[model samples]
Target: MSTAPPRRAPLFRRVAAALAVLTLPVAGLVAVAGPAEAAASATATYTKVSDWGTGFEGKWTVKNTGTTTLNSWAVEWDYPAGTAVTSAWDATVTSSGTHWTGKNVGWNGTLAPGATISFGFNGTGSGAPSGCKVNGGSCDGGTTPTDNPPSAPGTPTASGVTDTSLTLNWAAATDDKGIKNYDVFRGGAKIATVTGTSYADSGLTKGTTYSYTVVARDTIDQTGPASGALSVTTTGGTNPTDNPPSAPGTPTGSGITETAITVSWAAATDDKGVKNYDLYRGGAKIATVTGTSYTDTGLTKATPYQYHVVARDTADQTGAASAQATLTTAGVTDPPPGGAVKLGYFTNWGVYGRNYHVKNLVTSGSAAKITHINYAFGNVQGGACTIGDAYADYDKAYTADQSVDGVADTWDQPLRGNFNQLRKLKKQYPNIKILWSFGGWTWSGGFGQAAANPTAFANSCYNLVEDPRWADVFDGIDLDWEYPNACGLSCDTSGAASFKNLMQAVRAKFGANNLVTAAISADGSNGGKLDLADYAGAAPYTDFYNVMTYDFFGAWDAKGPTAPHSPLTSYSGIPIAGFNSEAAITKLKGKGIPGSKLNLGIGFYGRGWTGVTQATPGGTATGPAAGTYEQGIEDYKVLKNTCPSTGTIAGTAYAKCGSNWWSYDTPATIASKMTWTKQQGLRGAFFWEFSGDTTNGELANAIHTGLQ
Candidate 1:
């Protein structure tokens, strides 16, 4: 293995080059698929144009790829039992039961070399087309997968038990096409359809025991085998809501000491004067006081505690509980468990030319595989956080066919666009946590201003992410400060503590429940980006870090020797020292950051150039290779078929053809890297964006499988 030429500049302008617009939401889900793939001669590819609640629009592109003319092309596929083509346009579409066929129009049949034509049809039912054939050949220019249901979900775990409510969580199942949602059953009776890994079952009888199991359904609504049962017994007591005075306000703490603190809160308003306020440390009642304050003693020093209050009226009814307040005694708290965090970024702007959407997560089966989504990006400017794109965030209208819930957005709705759809997505996949990511390659220029007033920046972000209109859409916030005390799209000279201080401020505002994370740099050279900031010091304030381990090399250099942008290790003739993912992890770990707190980053696209003279790395080239979405950068979906892997180097795949070369991670390479990720005891793996994978999310699925 060998490296390529030196960097023109040690900067990765990925988003800036990939997207020129200044638009994205505070948070949203996004994904993409190639318009068409290759075939033996004339090829056809399918894409779901728009999905209304009741039906959707489907399109197919037929292209002549055999260096000859194609006179008339026919595409055929099978829809599930209830799904059918309702109408056709620019083509004659006909169906025999569930088997459908479409032929090019009389005037549009002929396609010369590199030429193409498209036809679309209105469809009912939610099933995607399968077994696609272009002019009697496989549509993928390879093997068409056999249709099969997903495997059974893992056995569930019961937690958060209460008299009337309890939560059930389980691992997700796997499928080739992708899992859509999970169906939970109680005592063999179907109870719920949820898109996430957990379910909170409520409205139950006290002292009752129930058996729960989960079954997964694929994108086509095919139910798989059910998980083993998990029996949960509700606590034996009156429902918390049945008893009450009004709920108390958030409790405040003062006179904090190593061993104790004075906790006070606003009193609950009750028609019957409040009899008492019951204070709790964690979930247990610690004290019953008639007044609004209590001095809790006997706490360990340098430990963290959570407190809440409930009110009881003269009739002894238990009022609702106040919001939980978290406090650390004497010192900062340690980071939590190092569980795996499989995260991905969802760009709000991808819905435009990419035509990706939140519903695509369900349709493409990605939502089932990912544990979290970092919606990129909100903006950081004027020393505070701000909306990246208002229209995309909460103002745009969506038709029922294009909406996540299959319900049309009303003009008078308080919120629409991605925010509304995200809220609906959470309702279906409650287990998939979302973070409002602020700043990226382009927007990060404002971090210098934000670093000057970290507290103000933190507060602004809190207010926006928690805004009532779409508050339910996000679980927390993610800082994508490209660099601190270093150069990125811009430069920052804030002291080393600036990064830690900003993270501390955000943690203070977001509290313990909500995730507070950041996309940190992975530069590992001496005195590089990692050395310029106090990431290790900030670990205490972060749930985990999404280490940006990609972009070590790319067409950013314009001309010269090609190399894998995201190399796993160093090799001969390397352009720079300590510029690989392994070096970054080693450096961070040496600095005392736990491996569990780090997630390895994977790129969903490739960066390359043309005019290459050799088939291997280190070959000189003229400039960047042509790309569909952006020059020098191409989505993996497109490259997988067009440039197919010609070789492997430094734990990644690369291709070379007729002076053209590109580097990207295939499902095979991704699986291998995931293996390395686990061996390193790292948290998990993540990718740049979702829309770069196949419609069925093969790359995302590979990550899911590798982690398992």
Candidate 2:
């Protein structure tokens, strides 16, 4: 099914490494709100809690726990006595008296929720101060001796019982440091300190009522308050009680006929161990097996049974029931939703600013019908946190008569670097429509500011995107708001309506023929991250929502098996946050986003974790792995050579070589995935960048053939 495009000579090659020249869409500056640009710093979150000359530099964790994300934010912490402003990186620090404030310096400030930002300064202090907190939470002032916190009362359950004795059980109590034993008090008098959860009160008069309470002590000998009293009286051995026997072990139901269920388990032991196991249908005991196992015959098909084991002594005394396990005798239903959705890449031809060359895809037979092609960025000005060189960054790049070089070399050449070349390429390729994208991972931080003055921001973006200089270059505008109504860098707190307003303004500016789209958050583990973005609220105004589903697993999780880069079913042993791209898509659909309006994501390059020793897939990768551009990770181009063997499961590719491993998409894997995409009734797919694919189009080939 895959098709490779014919090879052609290289065109529009730039000296600099491939950097997408995203453009801001506007003209003459107009009055708006606050300073367009915030001071830039690589690390954006800044908070000051201490003053200088206090002798202690303030150290804290800047947590993005709120729903709103922060692209860039500043924190001002006052220093303690004798603590002077010393050095800083990725931040600009200013000190006045005991007050010290550090602002985000350049294009850095990015703090996402559940993500912590930490920065510290050294100070001349004799020892740790008694008072130190982070974001108002208690902090470890310094590495010092500490005592454990008191444990909470555990859940008490009944256990062994006979005519003469009654036993009590409870859950284990945990302590910060360590738990000493638990004190079991009989009638308020200290009886014993047991290391475990069981206590037997024996040889007491059958009619005597015994009250028991437990308290957990720490390694520091600090005792917690006693648990609530639980009183029990042993019954005389004359009455016949309805004590059920223990449930059999390993109870398994298989080869189930419509009218019967064969339930099997290990033999029940007594010693009170298990006398027998009872099988219940809807909380009512249906059968009890005195032997090892039992078959509940004449059972209706599709019935559900709950089973439990209760051990009984020879005296007919019964122990507490074991945990309940469920069994369903039913017919299998139709197959679940098809595999991961497939996305397609739509880019301007091999031209200036739209540098994503289709040649790599075409030659590799990857001419897949992409649902959408998003043109790089649209500029915004007169909005909150607009970069200072806004207009000049693009104006300077435009040359004589509309024959333009797409970008300028540096910020110094203000009024340079626009997407004019992309306009020509779009004109030549009429079949593929390009949507002008405004804001992305880097520029998304300004959205809060844009929300404050939606009209001005919209006008500016509209002017640039619709400018006649590059008429017909774009079909519509795509809003790549990394996150809205929630945290990305700092937070907006501008309210959820801010996103809807921004989209409305954009829709008004671009008109109907133009596509209005947005890139939504892909963090679906808890559903909190994606829910905060409010994609459903903005869906009515958008043409499609691009789910950025990659970047789920990266070097961040080094020293582990590559999580299913794209998983189908949830599996244990995988971290809670672990989810495949399909999960996110399903969530969107469940949240009311139409499948046709959803565009899936594909990573052109693979994300890797290195320093591995195992050759097989799903094995641990030792760290710290080094990334192609940074640390602890590598890209697909580099990874193919370093670790070539791939693991094929659930239709995706992953590799583990020694202590290093990587999760990536090969030509074969992509093809298999595309089949599921068609079956799922999804719109299409999109990739992060175009340059990361194979030169001969192998990966693209799979996409093309599979989607076809």
Candidate 3:
């Protein structure tokens, strides 16, 4: 999945540890010089926010307690052996082995007397740093910064009343220092401290009177005055004779993808207000929602699914099930005159240690869901396309269990390995097309040479792909040239028009019905990889462009402020702007590529980090996380059970457990992405490779279901 060179330690250290001080005079103010000792004096406070086994997050605050204004400052600390700072914010951080130094950024360098600045970092290994010093002075037993308490919060109001919950909102309080958080109290007992003016109190008893109040607090832990209390009685109560809501009206299903379906029904009546509706599929309860509609996801393609709904009351009473609604989802249907396309990639090397043979596709049920699979990766050399591995592609023999047709390969057979197995798979699932992909990140070095003789290169590819020995195994050719005139594993100076020229040559030789396609860079940054080629001109010669929308960030940035590899939307504080699915789709369409000719990319695996101290994203890490195949990367099958998603950000799933943090898409997130794809008018979706999925193809199922 990563096209970049194998990761190593970063060459440049952005942070360094030193106990030096540099002072500069303030521009529009008269000098008030102080003694050297007094000017160098400062206070530092360290706080541990979270600790998860091998990693922890810590915050450091420095206050200028000297009489004269301090022009600049630096903080140094000795990290425990085996520990390292992976990321830092609000300061320039650098590390030398176990020692870390943080210097004030330009904006926070100058501090007047009594002024404080705070910065945080993520680190690896257990325990806290020791021997901390601020501006060459001991940080231990330093003076604590002081601040005044905030003003009293305003009276609270309750709304959206329910038997078990109510919403509370109050006016914000003021503070000389910033209001850090607000504490909410129920019946004289503190419940929570929130940063906003509102809180939702849930799990209450019906018909019970409850009183609520709020108090404000400043960053220095100063609690302010409490707001006037307000009391409210819940609207409903448990009653033996209370009637449950009637069964929901006959449910109707629509918007069917290969793996998901949206069902909606009319609301039912209830003596007590209806609390929620329960949805069932295949005689099993799937979900309960407060809305009239629900999308049942993670389904198998081409399968018949029956669904119904029932209503419930505040008393936890349920009604009868409504009439069943049945629907057969779209499967590996042939591409219609003009419709969505679902494509996936199959790697030849997976047959080895991963034990993912071609038969696994059929056994895992992925073959029936996918309309096309690209066989990766044939090599590029001598300015021509060629088979990457003769044994893996067509020479190695397959056992009966490993073969798609349950037949053993003969020693003297003309074709044996993955190619023959693919031929059999196509026979079984006739609608599933196959393409031979050449020149991935590792093998893209030859594209520059290939561009020099497009016609000759296309001729070579045609001969190999259309070879009489295994001609029917492939339906077309997919160019995975990494980049045209930009840098990947290697740089190319083939010029901006090179890619369009190459695609035009291939299309002219291969013809239109043969399905010419390419996987192109989705870097949405201005003047990025998309600007390095003439993709718009090449679009006319290709069936579609597979937009690699994932891998925007990862542990590849070893000293990382970790982020999701594939984020759907741009969230606040995203490391890079426009490096998201929305931005890619918009930019591609803006570049004159039709939405229907673009396919979104989803990663079947996840990118992660180790020695992660924070439970949420934006935390720093010591280095790449440990994985079975490669550090910093793991298959979804392992993470879904070992880590499990705890929360979501930017439309992707992330988890934190012990010292590791991982981000990948869950079934629910995939469904949402599929909806977005349709809304954007994109053709469909595809994942990197098939072998990373579960034995039953859980992530693959999610992709199929969400696309519908």
Q: Write the per-residue lDDT of candidate 1 for residues 328-384, one digit (tens) a residue.
A: 556433332555677888877666557788888888888989899998878887988
Off by over 4 Å in 3: 1-338
Better of 2 and 3 by lDDT: 3
Q: List the residue pairs that clash in candidate 3.
A: 15-93, 15-94, 16-94, 257-708, 259-705, 260-705
Model 1, position 562, has a per-residue lDDT of 88
TM-score per prediction, in order, is 0.54, 0.49, 0.55
lDDT of 1 at 49: 44
Q: Residues 605-646, candidate 2, lDDT per residue (tens digit)?
A: 665566666654455654334443234334465677877745
For model 3, state the Cα shift of residue 476 in Å. 0.4
Off by over 4 Å in 1: 1-338
Model 2 poorest ten-residue lDDT run: 1-10
Give lDDT for model 2: 0.52
In model 2, what is the error at residue 336, expressed in angstroms? 20
